[model samples]
Target chain A: MANKVLVLGEVREGALRNVSFEAIAAAKQIADGEVVGVLLGDSVANLAGELIAYGADRVVTVEHPHLKSYTSDGYSQAFLAVCEQEKPEGIILGHTSLGKDLSPKLASRLNSGLISDVTEIEGAGEDAVFIRPIYSGKAFEKVKIKEGIVFATIRPNNIKPLEKNASLTGDVASISVDVQNLRTIIKDVVRKASTGVDLSEAKIVVAGGRGVKSAEGFEPLKELANLLGGAVGASRGACDADYCDYSLQIGQTGKVVTPDLYIAAGISGAIQHLAGMSNSKVIVAINKDPEANIFKVADYGIVGDLFEVVPMLIEEFKALKVNS
Target chain B: MNIFVLVKRTFDTEEKIVISNGKIQEDGAEFIINPYDEYAIEEAIQVRDAKGGKVTVLTIGGEDAEKQLRTALAMGADEAVLINTEDDLDELDQYSAAYILAEYLKDKEVDLILAGNVAIDGGTGQVGPRVADLLGINYVTTITDLEIDGTNVKIVRDIEGDSEIIETSLPLLVTAQQGLNEPRYPSLPGIMKAKKKPLAELELDDLDIDEDDVEVKIEIVDIYLPPQKAAGRVLEGELSQQVKELVNLLHSEAKVV
Candidate 1:
């Protein structure tokens, strides 16, 4: 029998998170039997077609008013009930904030082993081997679970998301959740209002370090990111000094990003920072220092002041836009 | 509130890494308590001092890691427990280590458990949650700030730049991040006092876990150095010319323009 892989679809503001698609894409490659996705929200059934488009064969929707806001107990209970019924061969989830909090509890309830932040997964013998970064992305360790069920939490951006196939068909199953187990309640949710692009999911990331010199220096990076329809990122140093928004910081202590293209502006690459985004497909470094460590790993290096280089690049791009 | 902080000894971040024959060479390197775990120890001390409770530090490593256990004691843990095993066995992943630690804590009085978000060396960020699962406790990761009130713990964590405040009952697990607290350096008297503090050493047999159940299922095939990075092209010209050249490179060559 082919192994069944169940993915816990994460939702934010009543919408599917990008990582959810990434997980489904991964499941499509690793699972041989079926792909079932469990989603929890007040009215998440509406997103069923979206999940199917992303590769889920069946979408399980657990709806409850209490779940309108993300309460750990409520979300976990809903998913747990589904697991009890499905008894999937393997379970997958995003290693995001919500998934991190809930996956352990679910695993504990099922008394199963969990491999979190897995970078890759492949079949091995009766079970699957999960690969994860060890020693701070310095090495990879392949872990195999010799137990009843295989459980994994995948890091965001580790897999390329699959494109939606127009003919994909999905069946939406609505289920009710037990609200009694929910102990905590969310009073309010405050979102960072300035930008729509999430740095972790952006394909093109423009990151600045302390080399930017000042907070105002990020204006051009932001403009360029806007022009490219991507997001801005920053090194830990720039975030510590308040030169850029803390949300943009990328490193071991901050968000880990693996975008298609990563541009490091005015940043001397530190090991901690490099660990987060070194997996990016293409890296571009712009630093005045000829010996900046970033250039050592960057695919393209421009040794010059970012203030002078960034504005001119922006102007040239704008001219290209006008011409074409 | 009773708190237990877990610490791991790993290669220091500043140490220059060299890959020899596809394995890390550590002939002359120094190891220390993972920087993130120090925050866990510090938070445990602060919470214990404020609420009048006991803090026990736990670890699973080789005999040499005893130095880190002593350092945790010097940093103010009331007691320390070392789950000693073969030095080569220390290569066990976080899931294996967490299983051993959780099995040990199963018999102890533990109301709250703390750990770094992830070890600096491993950077896996999975141990805390895996341990919490093993212990059957609620788990919170990447906590930036925490406040304890009676049996309830309120925490604020950044989720992709948006902060979310999560409230959970006591006896839960929390993994500390870098900004949670500044780990205090052991004072002279503290170091002197820590030398005399009791360090309890326990073996896997002491924890009474079945070694057969935790056998190595996954074996590493090899570890190799990533390919050498390609040298970058230095775009030459005045600032304007350089910008135009960059635009051309991006459009014609790099193709990300």
Candidate 2:
């Protein structure tokens, strides 16, 4: 075995996403030898040192001018060049929008197979088993790579990144590839800018459903979310009812979140909705219906009207903060 | 213009998965066109209507898939193709499925291809890009909006919740994300018209593709349901007291606050 593993560090808006470090942690778990990190973009040289602090044995960067924004065509060319240069036996990437789009093309170019969105890895080296959710977290499967390279895309917020050790350092190597023939162009961007927190990575989530009544009904939930420094989420019911944009939808067809604290107000736990959030660490369900399916999975259930209960909880939380 | 949409028949988004004897029990399961694929199909038909082209819905499955193909036709697709894989193969991972689809599409003058961002059953979101790579075409994924004029194309892709505007050209493959467009239901007249729509069925031999060349590369070791959550505790008594207790519990017991 070549025993070298390659991990792709994802950079969004000039900063390294937490999952990039997490991918390095996961790569170290599955690699028997050196865990090398790869960065692509116009100016990602500064991030190589960050990767080294989090356990990357060395860093390889491709700083092509065309690699400023993520184009599948551009990234595939840059990454494939790195693969040829390194010839790593294993590869790890975050299963974000970029990885989901890029890894498949790279796998096809490599004549390899991919295990996408893996949540856990067991054992080390080629014999490692990757566990991934299927059927929107209702079921899980254990998969193993059977041919070519050990390629996998890991979901964010699952693997813990190696602790930052400023004392640790590694070599940084910059490489170049001819990135041309780009068929896609980036014209503009529209950022949601609703909350600073990304929903999938939020530690606490304040979510609403049809019981929130209307778009204005989400105001309180948003207030509480702002107070708690969390993100706002909505069930498919809320989105379909036109109360909120589908971008806020959280369910089987929407974003899947595993926050530490999930306060679901008026959201009857539809199977699809549960599949997205049932993994939250501490679920608090406030619904008028005592038998709302959410209560089944929640750690604490308040059988009352959310409009009333949520306000009171907010006040009480605030009071607690004051008294402390 | 030539446009193709890759469709898959999957368990309904609301259907509860039942695993029996180490396998997903599919008997009596209500299957529908993958919800995301519906977004792709609707976009395909809309593109064809604007650009003057044929919209073909293609899938790889058994005869049972004809029902889905008919559904696509009823939704305004001009034609359908079912590459039946039941007899020649038993299982399909992303790699083999992409291989088979690319094999069938290799000879066609493919201008644009649309597929769901991710199939709910597998949720890998791999096949479309894989097919594009195998055929040497450009691709984009999770596109919420698309526009075409002559050979020039533009797209709005969803990133987390933000939107990125992109420009591209034809001979492209794009995977549809949500909010592309509101999918239209198959009308009664459309269903009637679909009965007469062309649906061609082929096999591995039909494409001169050796089944051995498309062997699955990954092995599924096991499948099981996630652990069941313990029944929750429903608070009783006064509203403020309940609020007080809940806040205290979240702070002291769960340590999440």
Candidate 3:
């Protein structure tokens, strides 16, 4: 059966996040029918053109004062209203903070099946299979929805967005939704110092482990990351030792990241830590110990003190940019 | 106050996952109570100790899961319950699991329920919120600190890089985050006490839920290991030379720079 798939566009700081476009790409794969983009936030109607430029056939806008900030209750109620009216056969959303909080609740309310953090989609129609990581990244599971609506959240950077066509246009329709009696409310969103790139969505990530020694040791890694237009991460050991904040930790208990390039500096790759970043396209490990387990998974290994090696590499990169 | 902590038995995080014939090989593998759920269990015990309540650890699994329930009991839960689904079900998903749990708790006098932010194995982070939704109760996820006073609850939840403070009333559910508390190890005495503690085993019939009503919505089509990473090219020589070679490879080979 041809399925109308709804892609929920995510907005941050009044602009569409990159994952929104990535979600449109994922929705295009599952959607044999119309691909509709659903935008829910204050003044989100103007963002529909961007979704249309990617791949959405039409856009549905739900703007309300209550949805200015993302609260699970409020977003779920708004999304559920959109689902009820559209009765989409499938739903695709970014596997982000907002998606993680709202997808499960919406799926439960609709009695639908959900595959969260899906990295790939295979087949089509009723036979469509969604692939997601299990046991962290140690294993992958391909799941299918047996009945009801097919709901899935796509991890950012895994699915490439469709090329933009400025000529393409879609009908933008406004919908009235009654968002009321929310059990939870977001009085305000306290954003951390806004970095250029989201660590989870960055194309390149430079991570430090216990060998970084102290919080100050992260300076070189941060410099390399900044040069590469990326973000910085840390292992649980670094965070546990108070070398870095838990927010920067990437491991079994921390945020799972899959970037195009991952540089592990002074990290003795523990299984818990490998569970998070082993999926990166290219992994580079820098450690003085040649026998370090991180080398087992890295594409490139450098056996040297990160302090000396990192500064040298940074200088080399700088020289390359200047010469080019 | 009456507290419940939901626990699950998962493969040890350190165990190398092996998949055979499209399923995880479990024979001879070590299993432990999910590490995150340990934090939930510990938090429940502390709450019970301070607020004058009993903590009951619950799990929905087969007979093998009793070990995990016992571990939770050993960690200081006052009671334990194992909702055995071995005979009646072939598959289970988050929705079905939450449905069964909500049905069981709907009639119980529950003030607060605690669960891990996400099971390490599935990593979905869905069950706690789904159960709260099913029971029509308020819930907070990834909570680092929780304090209860009378009927009001104050919670600090992790939000990526920051934290958010929320205020709500009782009949609440919260998922324990990493920084919540240090989980206590099972002492010898605690282990012996756990062996004698009341561990009740119930079935779908006991919870008044039918097998069909709680049927799994999603189907597992295949399970397999991720593609293996190739052996790394270990760059040798002095620090400067290694750095030179690394940058050269990053530019020409990996094309990353």
Q: Chain A TM-score per candidate?
A: 0.92, 0.96, 0.97
DockQ numbers for every candidate?
Answer: 0.46, 0.79, 0.67
Error of 3 at B5 (Å): 1.1
**Highest TM-score: which candidate?**
2
Report the C-alpha lDDT of model 3 over B72-171, residue by residue, as the tens digit: 8888899999999999999899999999889888888899999998899998988988998898888888888898999988887777666677777789
Taken over the whole model, the C-alpha lDDT of each candidate is: 0.78, 0.91, 0.88
Ranking by TM-score: 2, 3, 1
Between candidates 2 and 3, the TM-score winner: 2
* lDDT, candidate 3, A134-228, per-residue tens: 99888999998888888899888898999999799999998898877766655444555224578889999999999999989999998998888
lDDT of 2 by residue, A1-324 (tens): 329999999999899999999999999988889999999999999999999999999999999989999998899999999999999899999999899999999999998889999988887776789999998888999998887799999988888899999788899999989999888899998988367678877889999999999999998998888888899999999999998878888888888888889999999999889988888889999999988899999999999998999889889888878877
TM-score of each: 0.91, 0.98, 0.97
Predicted complex 3: CAPRI docking category? medium
The model with the greater DockQ, 1 or 2, is 2
DockQ measured for candidate 2: 0.79
Give the worst 10-residue stretch by lDDT in candidate 2 chain B.
Answer: B11-20
